[model samples]
Target: MNNIEFIRNEEKKYHDFCYENYKLFEEGSWLYKPVKTVMDLLPLFDNNESLNVIDLGCGVGRNSIPIAEAIKNKNGKVVCVDLLDSALNKLKEYSKQYKVEKVIRTEKADIGNYKIKPNEFDFIIAVSALEHVKSEEVFEEVVRQMPEGTKNNGVNCLIINSEVQEIDLETNEKLDVLMELNLSIEVMMNKLSSIYTGWEVLKTVVNPLEYNITRSEKPVLLKTNAITYVVRKSIG
Candidate 1:
């Protein structure tokens, strides 16, 4: 296969993997918790004014629900975008359960194809999402657009799996490896700093994690090097 085809195949495999295991994102599952990185940025929003938020790859309203609750009284709304219909439906249900349904909207779309309108959102989040894009070009394009997609002084938070190695937790057999950036942490940080020049970078962290998964009724662990970027656009 050519490079484009290889990338497409990999993207499809990842999507199919998530779709097949959609049950793991059910409301009661461990995957249904809000991300701490996203939560920590909540206090930065203007409490007296309504805000428009967009969450890319917002699976099952894990982060979306909490955001909705945070902004519900402020006349804020959250636009949730994801690839899976099942996941979006669950988000809708969870929104109602949390009584934030009025302020939550769901859209089903692949993040790779989803376009962000300029100056459209007050807060934008892409947690564990953008790394799945098919190519470096697409990834860079998405990152480049994020600043323009936000309103002046708007905030954007992103958490991505930069590199990972999958292993069986029981036998410790190496299963698979995925490196979205394939660049070292230092290089990645430099690239981000260069990209967001003139913008305020609140936090940049590289966190290594051991994520647990189940394959063939066996526990598997993914050793991941994740990176987070929290940035705010300046009113210019």
Candidate 2:
């Protein structure tokens, strides 16, 4: 299936609530807090080097526009990568309207198979967009392709579904599947770090969380919002 199909399938079946709650996540709402939390990590941007940031699986520019606004004054720029044309088109228009167009460059492509420079980015963000990636191998591949040391001293932010948890159902008292929507960060450092020791190249990893309790208390099992780690990434 194509990216849109992939996304729609996930949203409709697993995360329809997040999609339906998009308006609140759009600008200034409680749901938008997570996006804001993601941008707050930008303080790590030293701005000494040419700022090259990447927004992986950027959906409609929620986090992209905010990052662009924050770094527009500096010699910084953002590259938003996504698999959906609909999201890219909307990001284009929003960047223009927000007056950060000059600082934002968007690309329509799949992260699972895209050819990106190794360690080229000063920052890489994957906000609320990992569950859709599905396979651990694919997820690792995306990281493997990252410009290795190019992100030296850089930060990579990620939001994904944490390990599944069990919830007791009121009806039958049987345990049900529940997961925490997680917010995590990975940093790229020079020397080795504890939080990062996966593929020789990753520097460090970071995690900061802000979650929304699913509004519905229906019989359906619901997941929680959780922020998992804080680490670094470096290339081999």
Candidate 3:
């Protein structure tokens, strides 16, 4: 299949999986926690000033809710973008419970098709997002648009899957995975450096993790390499 088609299939599969197991996105579930990487960088945002933020693939307001709460007093707003309506609906419910519903807006759009407007946001985060763009061209275009999308001195945090091995649950054998990036840490950093030359790199980390999942009544382990980057646009 072609890149766009591959992405569509992967998205459908993921949506179905999440729909079948929607409870995992409930308020108290493990996946509902704010990402530590994002939490760590929260202090950098100026609480006194209104900030425009975007959370790509903001699953169930895990990070977006807290962010909205933080910036609510400042009249800051967070635009949440995700491919699944179910996820966005859950996020809306959580936002209301958190009392930050006014500060949060949800949009359903695939990352590959979403357009990032120039100088649009003061803060942008994509936790475990962007890696789903199966098309290298699409990924490059997104990266290219980031610098312009961010206002001067704006901050951005991205946590992406750099490498991962998918295993068949029934046989516990490695599957021929076609959906994710498999770049080494160095290569990934180099690519980011090339794309984000207008930004100052504040942090770069590569985390090695083993994720266990059950499929077909068998346990499958995924050796995952996750990369986190915190960058700020250079002052013009």
Candidate 4:
């Protein structure tokens, strides 16, 4: 199929899967908890009286919920954006359940097409989200906008999956990976390094991961290199 068709199919798959998974923060699941790295960085903005944060493609407030709790007392707001309505609906429920409803605002939009205002946010996070953009060009443009939208001394934390491969466990046959912008490890690193030039690289890590997952009722072995790159925008 063509790129657009593939992307549409992928979106539907995710939408259905998200709707089926009613619980967030469930034990032993991929969404078991928020990323520790994201939580660790929240203390850096403790002194700010009012904080503005953006979470691109935030799935059911996995990271957004904790961030809202951290900044609730300081008039902090976490703008949670996702393409799926079900995810956002669940996030709203969780926000109310956690008593931080006032701190979160939800927006439904494709991350690639979402516009971020310049120098507006103290923290911008896109976890396991960038790789789903429509293409590598869109990925670069979004990355370009991320730092531009971040205020000086602000942070941008991105967790992207690269070099994804899937194999049918039952037949040991290779299957087409559904990612929209599945760049090679080398290309992905180069793009980040070039775009984030002069920024303070607080953390840079690449973890090779292989896991078993069920997709379309078939067991599959998914292999990917998960890259975490966190940087602070430098002030002139």
Candidate 5:
């Protein structure tokens, strides 16, 4: 299998396994580990407020289901988008089982192709999603689509533990977004401290959105290289 085909197949295998043993992970120690780590890296969220969320590259609905439950009580919704049919089906099932069907919306689209409303999301999240997308253009396009903030100031945050290389297709330029840099809660909080202050704080804290690095010049890689970025949107 080629790169694209290989990724598709690997995704299939993953879904097949997750669908069968999802219960083992759901609310279990095995499941919420990464989630806890990710949440720790985030700013505070209110329990009684409503917000909008988009789960890009939602695979097998594992993260989607929990996200739905976490946000439902807050009157928030999670739009789960993915390219694979199997993953969507599983998300639907989980939503129904968890009684979050009303809170979760599933979409069948190559995440890299859609135009997202910039700064529109109260929260934008991805779970190990970016590394698999095939095209840098498609990936960057998604970022450009995030709609500028229309309501209260919002932000976008994404974290991924993998290799990252920023390559410009138009100019063939390259930059390093992050390297073996896991955007942990500690790092994120520190960055925000420098950015936020009394009366200057915003409603959302999702910025410096985390997308996947599509290229590489080196062979050495680290597993803890997840990066988290926060970009805030201001309500004009």
Candidate 6:
């Protein structure tokens, strides 16, 4: 299958299945929890009342719910964007359940095509989302826009998967990696550096992880280098 087809299929299979069967933060599920790193960096903006944040590929408000809860008193807003109707629907339901509906907004759009408004956000996060973009160029463009979309003293947190290697468990042989834009570690780092120059780099980490899963009805082991980058836009 081609790139777009592969992406759609993967999205339908993984995202649809996961969001359908598993409750957010359900025990033993991949969606068991939100990224702690994202949670950790939130306090940096604590002093900013009226917070505005963007969560690209926010699935079912795992992180967005907590974010809304944190900033609700401050009149904070978290714009949760995803391509799936089901995801957005669940997010809305959960926001009301958590009593943070007033602080949450949902947008249905593919993150690749979703434009970030200039200086419109206090914080922007895309966790394991940008890799699914159509191409490396698209990825770079999105990364370039991240800082531009942030207000001064605001932050951008990105957790991207790079250098994916899928292995067939039974045969012990490598299989075709299915992500749309499987960028190399070097390339990913270089682009972030070039685009986010002069920003206060808070964190840069590369964690290698392995997961066993059934894909296309076959048991496979997926390996990836998860890159986490957090930076702040210095006030001029």
What C-alpha lDDT, on a 0 to 100 scale, does residue 103 get in candidate 1?
96
Query: Model 1: per-residue lDDT, tens digit, 204-223?
Result: 88899886765545677877
What's the TM-score of each model vs. the native?
0.85, 0.65, 0.87, 0.95, 0.63, 0.96
As a TM-score, model 6 comes out at 0.96
lDDT of 5 at 85: 81
**Quick one: best TM-score, which candidate?**
6
The window of 10 residues in a row where model 6 has the poorest summed lDDT is 6-15
> Order of candidates by lDDT, top first?
4, 6, 1, 3, 2, 5
- Tens-digit lDDT track for model 4 on 1-236? 98777766765675558546646787755677899999999988988988999999998888999899989999889999998877898899999999999999999999999999999999999998999888889999999999999998999999999999999999999998877888888899999999999999999999999977767878889899999999999897
Ten contiguous residues minimizing lDDT sum, candidate 1: 23-32
Instruction: Tell me how candidate 6 scores on lDDT.
Output: 0.89
Angstrom error of the Cα, residue 104, model 5: value is 0.9
For model 1 the local lDDT of residue 118 reads 94
Q: What is the C-alpha RMSD of each candidate to the true structure, in Å?
A: 3.3, 6.3, 2.6, 1.4, 9.4, 1.3
Backbone clashes in model 4, listed as residue pairs:
none
What TM-score does candidate 2 get on C-alpha atoms?
0.65
Candidate 6 per-residue lDDT over residues 2-103, each given as its tens digit: 668976786668777778888987885667888899999888987886899999999898889888888999878999999888899989988989899999
Tell me which residue pairs clash in candidate 6: none
Ranking by TM-score: 6, 4, 3, 1, 2, 5
Clashes of each: 0, 32, 0, 0, 16, 0
* Runs in model 3 lying further than 4 Å from the true structure: 1-30, 178-180, 214-218
> By lDDT, is 1 or 6 better?
6
Please give the distance, in angstroms, between residue 95's alpha carbon in candidate 6 and its true position after superposition.
1.4
lDDT of 2 at 195: 29
Clashes of 3: 0
